[model samples]
Target: MRESLGDFAIGRLDAEEAATVQAHLDGCADCRAELAEVSSVLGPLSTVDAARLGDAPVPSPDLGDRIVAAARAEGRAAERGRSTPRRLTLAAAAAVALLVGGAGGYAAGAYDGIPREPVAVQAMEPGVEVSAVAIPHTWGVEIVLDGDGFASGATYRMVVESKDGREVGAGEFIGTGESKMVCNMNSSVLRGDAEGFKVVDTSGATVLRGDLTAT
Candidate 1:
């Protein structure tokens, strides 16, 4: 069952196997904890573009050895009845290695070759400060928002607009006020077609606007 936790977290297991794991997790606190850890590590990987992975810088041999060492330690811990799952341990180790090897930077639009358009964010209200970048992907565009000073517990929607006035909902998230929020919203509209992005409150009031066309 522990070997299947990694697959379960990534949705790779068949329905029957997943159901069994779900049942086990429901009754086992230790397994639930392990699953949570695995999910935290793997969650960000879901948004990664697999095709661009080959372009990521390779890790040094020492880094590879360290990853292997960490995986072995996790396996030993599992043998001692610890909560760490063997498969999940390996998956987490691989994720760490990839991130450390520079894939993480690529995912964040840090690659020089990748075209990242800076969005000029204007806060409509007095208390909010926001900044963003638009990164184009094969599937669509990824809008990375970094900001502080939003109303706590308030929900905001990101809208992507085209030059012709067509609007598309990128995504939505709850605000945490001054905690320095970082969000990645994706839209099916291509970056070239997108004219700007707007952060709107539930009442349909635009609180923040970023003009991509000007950039």
Candidate 2:
């Protein structure tokens, strides 16, 4: 019964197991107290970052509840034989929070408040064009890399530097061999007064550098 508490805390119990846990929760005051404690900490997991970083738009207020409800509606949860440990539960909560935040906003195209017109950065390689567009509220910048010179399966890292000399990892993506890659950059550097950007190869050599503040 106590082990069930962990699974229930993280929403990992199946419908039958969940019913059993609910029945126990209805009677065991200690378990119920612990459950409330866990929820209080994890429930707001989805909205914490948006409130802290930049002015990014937050997900629906009911997002955490909705996620739990959706899991219940699935009728099948993760196996009941394995109870998620408390630490793992917390990590999962954070992961869910991030996924719900970025994927939701990106899928909804909720960049209306942000600038759509891209500020073109000088391209280093011939036929290689790069542009950066700031997504307001979310404090993210969308970087679009296109054209040739990108090696297939090569990972390119885009680093942003703030006006204050602080450098931040803006985004990273692998070349798809299609000559185009679009990535979302979420960092304090881009959110703050960004100074410039540098595209580095796997060996950390700066392949391209451009002043983002320049027209």
* lDDT of candidate 2 over 123-181, digit per residue (tens): 56454555555443345454434334556788888888878887788778775554655
Clashes (backbone N, CA, C under 3 Å), per candidate, total 0, 3
List TM-score per model, in order.
0.52, 0.43
Model 1 lDDT tens row, 1-215: 77788999989999999999999998665578789999998968888989998896878869988999999999997788745576688899898767745554423444545566677889998789877889877577889887787799999999999888889999999988889877889998877688998999999999999888963
Best by TM-score: 1
Q: Please identify model 2 stretches exceeding 4 Å from their true place.
A: 1-111, 138-148, 190-192
| Candidate number of the best lDDT | 1
Worst ten-residue run, lDDT, model 2?
A: 105-114
The TM-score measured for candidate 2 stands at 0.43
Error of 2 at 37 (Å): 33
Whole-model lDDT, model 1: 0.83
